[model samples]
Target: MRKHVRKLKDELVKRGLDAFLAIQNTRYLAGTTAAKAVIVPTDGPPVLICSRLEFDQAKREGWIRDVRAFSRWRAPLRPGERVSFCEPLQLIADCLRELGTRAVGYDRGGKKFVRKLRAAHAASYRELPELMLELRKIKSKEEVTLLQRAAKIAMNGMRCAAESVTVGRTELEVAAEAEREMRIAGSEGTPFPTIVASGRNSWLPHASATRKHLRRGELVVIDFGATWGGYASDMTRTFALSPTKKQLTLIGLVKRAQKAAIGRVRNGAKASNVDKAARIIISRVGYAKFSPHGTGHGVGMEVHEPPGLAPDSKDILRERMVITVEPGIYVPRVGGARWEDMVLVTKKGCKSLTA
Candidate 1:
């Protein structure tokens, strides 16, 4: 927590701001639901404003320095009475004003606070959401460990999903089996809704599990992920319930395309180049129109992060960055084939973290 505060303070200094305010709810971070606010000055320990219910926990966790409790309005005030309403925005503005702060930096959401500050005090504020995002893009050592664990859980879930595919099985039943495997493998839950598209339903991107039964000689796409330790891992692997010659050909083409994309992902390469490599392979096989989404996206604390692998994205690949390389070709009413893997960008090349 102190390290994060220092990073925020450094960002404020770079942006020429006096302080930064971070308002978050405990529901966002599991184990607590108290609303909390932190004030990070350029060169000092962070001050925490939290409810009475969270003060003790925050202190024991060593998350901040000052933990002040908010009070409610009453007819007769008690000895330790404080402000009635602890609206994060108003409290932040009041703190800044008291500290004679003229300029501040914060995440880009507090519109009411900004309005009140502009009207009451002639203060200037800068949005520093990008600064925080950039800081979070590069994973720390501990973060990488957690992500790797998530990938392993996801792989286990994928294997269960594959085994669940059979003739006369409903999409929902397969999804339930996958979810059960994920939980047994130590995943808190699925990162997103499990996609158990079988037969014709496999053609639709982001298809929800339905009552449709798996048919013989039909393709099934099981796109799923698992979340562990607040980190997420995403992977999509298509299956052949009892595939025909045509379905096998499409799956083979998609696998080749995904391999081509993964091969292009290395340190110092532009993300767009990876997308192009995959697109080239699919286009050569006459499946260019079927590929709609980007090649992949960064995955960690958030499922979708910066450095998207797409033909138009301008993000450059960097070492130690974890990302997904998924390539697909979806044919309407027929089926789609997609293969995905979690990769860690290395100095020389990329390593498949989940493999």
Candidate 2:
């Protein structure tokens, strides 16, 4: 947590900002809203302004030192009248004004608030959504540990889903079994809604589980993730109720493609090149047009983060980065095959945590 704060301060300095801020109501790091605010100045300890309802929890969990009741903030106590936030800017601007800040960088998606802040306070504000993603791209040691544990738990769920998939079983039933296994193994929740795409539905990359029952000679694509300690792990594997030569062939192609992609992961490697390694093989087999999505994405506090592995991406892999390698093939009316695994980028290459 201290490291994260220090990094934020460094970014503030790099961006020529006196301070930075983010607002969120819930304890989720991904949360961003007005009900709760975090103020981090380049020169001092951070402060968190939260509702009285969650003040105690924030004080305990938030790494900030100063915890103030958001509701108690008044627009410069008036002598004969009441003041409100309508006239004053957001708490971030308020903090900067109090610190005599001249420059500030804030999270994105607050055009109205940003305009009001510039009008009300003499400070420069820059939107920093991409900045935030860049800061979170490299995983810390603690984060990697949690991701490894989450991968272990998620693999158990994948196995459960694989075992539960048989002829006559509903897609929902298979998904339920996988989720139950992950929960039993100590997962707080699934990062995404569990997917149990069966038969024709397999062609849909992100299809939701339906009531359709599995049948012999059809494919079942189980894509899911388990969350532990706010870290997430994503994995996917296609199954066959009854094996066929063509089905096996497609699965092998996807597996080999993923292997080639994972082999390309390591420090100082371009993510686009890694994606190309897999795309070349898939495209050579006449299934390039069928695979419409990126090869994979960085996994961390969020299921999909920065450092995307795609043909058009400029992200470069670095040590301690956790990413997914998923290669797939989809054929209309003939079902599809997708093989996915989580890996930790290392100096030499990567370790498959979800293998």
Best-fitting candidate, measured by TM-score?
A: 2
lDDT of 1 at 110: 68
- Please, what are the lDDT tens digits per residue for candidate 1 over residues 216-274? 87889888888877788888889987678888888998889888988888889999999
Model 1 segments more than 4 A misplaced: 23-36, 49-62, 69-84, 98-100, 117-122
> TM-score per candidate, in order?
0.88, 0.91
Error of 1 at 337 (Å): 1.2
How much is the lDDT of residue 163 in candidate 1? 85
Tell me the lDDT of model 1 at 203.
85
User: How much lDDT does each candidate structure score?
Assistant: 0.77, 0.81
Top candidate on lDDT is 2
What tens digits encode model 2's per-residue C-alpha lDDT throughout 230-265? 789999999987867888888999999999999899
Task: Tell me the spans in candidate 2 whose CA falls farther than 4 Å from its real position.
Answer: 24-35, 72-90
